[model samples]
Target chain A: MTSLPTHTEKKLGLAIDLDTCVGCQACVTACKGWNDQGYGAPLSDQDPYGAAPSGAFLNRVHSYEITPDQGAAVIVNFPRSCLHCEDAPCVPVCPTGASYKRVEDGIVLVNEDACIGCGLCAWACPYGAREMDGDVGVMKKCTLCVDRIYNEHLPEEDRVPACVRTCPTGARHFGDFADPDSTVSQLAKQRGGYDLMPDLGTRPTNKYLPPRRKDAPDMSAPLAPLLDIQATGFAGWLDKVLGKI
Target chain B: MHPAPSVIVFTVLSGMGFGLLAFLGAGLPAPSGWAAFFHWGLGYSLAVGGLLASTFHLGNPQRFLRAFTQWRSSWLSREAIASVACLLALAPVALSNWLGFGWPRALGLIGAVLALATIFCTAMIYAQLKTIPRWNHWTTPALFVAFAGAGGAILAGQSGAGAVMSALLLALLLAAFRIGDGAFAARAQTLGTATGLGTIGPVQGTVRVFEQPHTSPNYLMREMIYLVARKHVQKLRSVTLIGAGIAPALLLPLTPPSLLGFAVIALVHLTGAFAARWLFFAQAEHVVGLYYGQR
Candidate 1:
């Protein structure tokens, strides 16, 4: 099972927009809530109310504050998850046939029953996507909401991943990337969507929309004098009031 | 990468075991009767015991039997297969030698080749990982082979001349491994490349951790973001070089050619090998560490 298929028919993945994300972490919580009770094991936490609390979740949002010397300051909220790569490195490294890529939808999944929980797949991944569930002794990752996405009981609109549905700013999009005319594919082409660590050749299925630069007012030009030092306080106040009116 | 105790024990002990088997298979004179039994017992104890120790590292040790089935793709599985084959082939030879009638030379030759192949497979498990910049190199397996050969020569009571040659080779390989490991640069990916922010401007400009997603250490941080202090690392490197390389090279040559001398040299060399293996895991910088700004 570690030997990858020649090609999967459909590449179902997420396209995240960096420009619109607010770093609210709603998607992270939603993913935990859904996966905890659904599909596999619960996203268990140790000492939740104690001083040191840690829990395993499929998604995490990292905030980077970029203060450039000359350009405008940019704050980027990067949400990290499994890109579900076409040539997933995690799959081949697994000793047991636990880590596998789906032939149907191209969704990479871990077979908990077959896993020996060696943690080699985690070491193989360039992205910090896979987490070893200590409670159950198996690797856990983003299933792309495999349970809910295919369930007939769910509403048509609710068939998407929990993370995608929970995104407040609509930053996350889930669709079949194989379809050239699909909304996800079109958005990727239009916004110049790019892959993370393209050099590694994992060929990640998820695409990230680069943050657009905002045009700032030019500071190079000579500034107009705010107020003449020679002018009286009363005159300056009157000028400011007249300018506002 | 954390220097897990089980892995360290497995690599060092198993390396010696395979090394002894390789020398034995290469026609190191098979001792008569009880001596042959004792020799075979020692080799199996080291090799099989080390292999068993490695299972402790797995989260689900009971499910380890399934690991042998993925030999088609997984290096770990290949290592398992090679190791089992080496043991099986060597066992009959050892048994025949114990009964005072050694097996044919061809069978011993096959076992020797398999023993070396087992070590190579074990090294490949680490070397094949593109994620770790330090371990992804040809020199890693070479080091493994050299260490195993040197340890095996000493453990098997090889002739004084052979032991001296192995010690010298070990020294050269250790030096080469150190230099190569130091000189190699990580050309694959950086924080800028990982985030796709390098396309916009300099990635260095955007390298700041505003906030972490979790307050406490998560599994990723514990497993991947291990940090060994520079001072400690330097000290350990010196210890490894002296214990595994210089001391063995010098002491093995100078000491009287006796079982006790060989035993002393073996013990000293193993200490160095252990230190070296620890450094192997500790210094390896995983690409995922870049995501956490640890790079």
Candidate 2:
């Protein structure tokens, strides 16, 4: 019962544009607000009014500073959440058949009622997408707004996930990757949307478009001695490693 | 890996119990009447106590009954089934030995295999996790079976076999540590691959976390990003090598053939088993820790 579906009918997922994300955390707030009442268990905060306040959140935006050889350091806001992998490791490792991936839309979800809270699923996941709810003792993760996305009451524009809806910069996009014509799929093809930790072979549904090059150096101009910039730092080290591979 | 005391206790105690059961089932130091009662009593206490301790590792332990339903796919479920089967299969033999009924010995033999499997299942729970490269190797299961076999041999008063198993265990433990030290690095999971930023293009300096998502501890940080024992891992590794492996290997061959002698050797071995189990969890490096720029 914990085995993954042979195939999902529709790969419904998000395409997060890192180039425009400002790391305002508005989507995090929106995700928290919607998931608190919309999902299986409400997000709980321990010691919210006291020292060491912590709470469960479906979506979190992390800021990273990227520095290039010859320019200012560029800060990219990376939002971390469940990638809804096709071969989700979390599902097969579940001892109670609590963690499962949907065959219809390919969204990974935890059945709170069946969950024994053994936490093996969380350990199976390399991306740390699943979190054990301290208050409820069941695993919780990004549902991709399963309730809201299919709800008939919500208007067409409002049917998207709360994270996509509240992203002020329009950095988050929602669509089905199953259809080649879908916006998400096209974006993936055009912008090179890639998986997180491709080495693990999870085959994540959600894709992240790399931040566009910050400063464009003119290639047509003749090579000048002063302009001969040798790549250094992490990218140089990375090139050497990739060269080894 | 948080190295919760419940899980550590479960592995150490249950491992020794199952090991003893295996040896007894195989007719090592076969006994009758009062002797059988004493041996079975000790075995069951350790086995049952260790199994019960695992129940505390669960947040909703009452629902652990559901853990049995997914054995076809889950190792933890398989372990639950195996442990129960082993205990049940051995009960009749234990009673037969105690009361001189002379019931079929096949029951004990079946239980022995199951107990060995139970130990393997416990190891697979950690070994199956690819997220932790260090524990994902075959050595994990080998180490588990070794510890149980050595510890069980000591409890059964088979000093020669105990000494031999302990020496093998020592060799495996050292190899596991040596291989494990490079397992994470061999995988090359870095902040670069973690975020896919390292593959994008060259950067000015490096890809680094400018700010974390939250100020306070979250479930991911609490459960996966544990680092309390990182600094003292070298010391703890020594504790495992000396206590669980070396002491038993050297002393078992010299100890007199007596229950009291085995008890002392077993105590020394079990102490090392506890420390080794602790290091198994403490030293495991989860890939999720890369998000926080950790191992």
Candidate 3:
């Protein structure tokens, strides 16, 4: 019989509350700042002040405008990054064992020393999570701030990932998903959180809470009288020329 | 998706190597004396070299033994297992020939079967990746088989008459299959409207990259760009068709008896097939690229 470790079955994950998120992009900046300083080489840019400036970043925010017929403008801001899946497609596809999921903590990591800059892991990922560091020629992604999470020097509150810690709106929460009583698990259950692209079957550990809306404001009410057309000297001439009341 | 060069080289080289071996072992006439020995030796060496090169793509070389365990779910695992089997089968054939024990036809046949199986497994690795719709189709495996046959024919043409006709036939079949598949893929507009934006209408918006998901270029963009233009593809296809297919066909019937015709055919086929394989990877598109704001 094949023997496998039962103790390593527990997986930690993240719960992101979309309703509470203010889209500050604080987490994005924090993640870039931390990752650039730790583990791999710094995220270098080709031209810091040029027309076509480009560099590496682990997290990014996507803004979308959702216009419903009965409600005010609902702007949805989605922060995208690696989900740190239970079945990470990027890990095993690595021809070099440089990309691997830790059997202990379920963290997917790339061993830069073993990597030949082949860039196969990046191809395997559906999330667009992994990025090739041009300077180092090795692949890199969100480590979930592995070094800080396990460091004994840090306090319990500050032990989470830099992105989670830096989130100003308390939208991001991280904990062991295997433990039912964990805050992330409880929040997910109460809020009906969902994984992005669940059809891919990656079994991503991170979950996103659907955007919720309160009662819509009444738009059918009669409008107040319009402002005077000739209130200002420049406005009177412009309104007359433009044929506005 | 990133089309790692080592992997591309490994698949292309081994496809030719094992392909030639299998074709020879499939009852094609064997060259006599040192010529026969050199042909078999070189083909096997190329196959083994390709396999070894693939190991560089792995992160933990020591744990490679574990790859064979996941054959049930992973095509990659199946490929590893099949490659090992092919190598094992080649051992006896090589041994018998070197020791002057016997004809070793039975061992050769076994090696050939394993080699074909390995090529199939390698093709399935790409065919099975659902993320890449272009590669996931039936054409992928057909392309693999065709390329292998084409490569084998080239080798046979180089060695002697035993292979000339067979190589010519395989090259013709591969050329036809690739051209047909490319045309079919070009016509399929399933990818254009799958995102639920609308029907297969012309793009109306000024679809520029307003803001990317990340500041850095991610894996999705790098792997699935499939950046080749239609004009370049047409040119490459014509070149491959002539060099890998047509030239080999014409050369097989024209050259004087001996190995001269075979050598010319083999050289043309190898170069042509390499170009074809490069185009194969360069033209394949991934579904994830749609998310990168690419049409």
Candidate 4:
């Protein structure tokens, strides 16, 4: 007889490639749309169409403009979501064990029925992945589209997460990071990717590759006489307003 | 941070409970009949519920006993020890009151001091966490004490306090508000320190949101992005100053010893105190805001 899979043995997770990523937010949109209608209660909004309409989003992208002393403007687009860490801090903090990391497949999920709407998990998380579903009185976050990934009805390739599948720039990738031979692991190794805020020592599964540049730009180029003049027509006025050439 | 509703409820409920018990032990007159029973039962029940709710904040509730070991350096540990001590002190006081010992005045004093100490310890837990700038303040402990006193006084008035004690408690509530304002100033100073800038001076350079460190809101923003309108803060302060402060001060001195007056005072104070506590947590900013490039 074949042995059944145990929680400790199986590992599942995601790896993102920053090298090829063009900063598109396809993954963010896809995650929101998928998680919004999936197994858990929809992310609640205080004022959906009114002023200050803020709601819970499972995934979001942050753009950072890093200006090195002698280099061109480097815009680093960081997509933030649940890292689904092997040592997930959010799990043990939950009093009811509602927030738990699955023994099998290593997926961190929230059991809505058991959640008491306490925001402790939210406080424990350094990533801010989790949010309170105020309407249902429970915490919610990215499940990595657990239901879709394991659905037998779907095609084998389509069984992967909606975010991974929808990513236009191929920035988001899903696989077992535990297995060194997996595509994500190989990519992470090859590109020398780094985790966000590694000092926290959460050992986040998601890795980000720092933006690389080849040569420094020359800022000492001689300026045109028209450009150097402080006063002129429309172009001069625009330059004065923006404080830029 | 997302103030867990259970925790919010727990703190408020327990503050009232411990506060009421402490006040009763502080030489306040004994309440009569069902009112007195509720004063004791509700106070202890809320205290238990608050402690239980706080367990949810821990990574391992089962291993919470280990927390007591760190009392040497940890305010959380001190809070745990103090809370347990308050419970132990209350046991004898409760037993004596039941046995018709005329409300064991000495034990009452002990329980009251312990209860206030627990509240102070609870505030210190947050104040000690250097990461959360909003919590790390001398005012936090004072605020917790005030809330406890206010909540307790309100409950006492409802449970039948004579005009003198009511007036005295009311005065304490006003003193708490003044202390809270001082705490707010401290919080603002600490926030400025966290940003690596001194004081609330105007920005010297053209500040622009060029790029953020992350694409999405991280833990810092989620916990500390507690934005309330300036106008609303002003309005709430005014209401608290009057309802929780001035009204209690004026009415307690004039009102006759009646349950109706007490109930009105209790309800008004409870609402005002809760608002004050909420604002206390919300208005305070953290040092982590510096990472987001916000001053």
DockQ of candidates 1 onward, in order? 0.60, 0.48, 0.14, 0.06
- Give the per-residue lDDT of model 4 (tens digit) for B1-295: 4444555666777777788878766756465455556667767887888888777654335656654554544455577788888888876666555455565477778888999998887776565544344555565676677667766776666333323333444465455446544543454423223221121122112222346634454334766665545347767766666666556656766777677887787777667666666665666544445435542
Worst 10-residue lDDT window for candidate 4 chain A reads A1-10
DockQ, structure candidate 4:
0.06
lDDT of 1 by residue, B1-295 (tens): 8889999999999989998888777678577689888887888899999999999988899998888989999999889889999999988888887896756878888999999999999999998888886787877887888888888888888646445655665666566556546532536465666787655533225556678877678889888888856348778877788888778777776787788888888888888889888888877778888778883
Per-residue alpha-carbon lDDT of candidate 2 for residues A1-245, written as tens digits (9 for 90 to 100): 79899999999999999888999999999998998998798987888899888887878888888766556678888999999999999999999998989999999999899998889999999987888887988888999999999999999899999999989999999999999999999998888898999889899999998888767666555567569766699988988899899
In candidate 2 chain B, where is summed lDDT lowest over 10 consecutive residues? B197-206
Give the Cα lDDT of each candidate.
0.84, 0.89, 0.67, 0.63
Among residues 3 or more apart in sequence or in different chains, the pairs in candidate 2 whose N, CA or C atoms overlap within 3 Å are: A67-B203, A67-B204, A68-B203, A68-B204
RMSD (CA, angstroms), candidate 4: 11.0
- TM-score computed on alpha carbons, candidate 2: 0.93
- lDDT for model 2, on a 0 to 1 scale? 0.89
Q: For each candidate, what is chain B's TM-score?
A: 0.92, 0.97, 0.80, 0.77
Of the pair 2 and 3, which is ahead by DockQ? 2
User: Per-residue lDDT tens digits of candidate 3, residues B179-277?
Assistant: 545542463433222221122112111122334555555444655675645348777776777776667666666666556666666777777776677
Which candidate number has the best lDDT?
2
Clashing pairs in 1: none
Can you tell me which runs of candidate 4 are displaced by over 4 Å? A1-11, A43-54, A214-245, B1-13, B22-131, B136-208, B211-223, B229-279, B286-295
Of 2 and 3, the candidate ahead on lDDT is 2
Rate residue B212 of model 2 by lDDT: 87
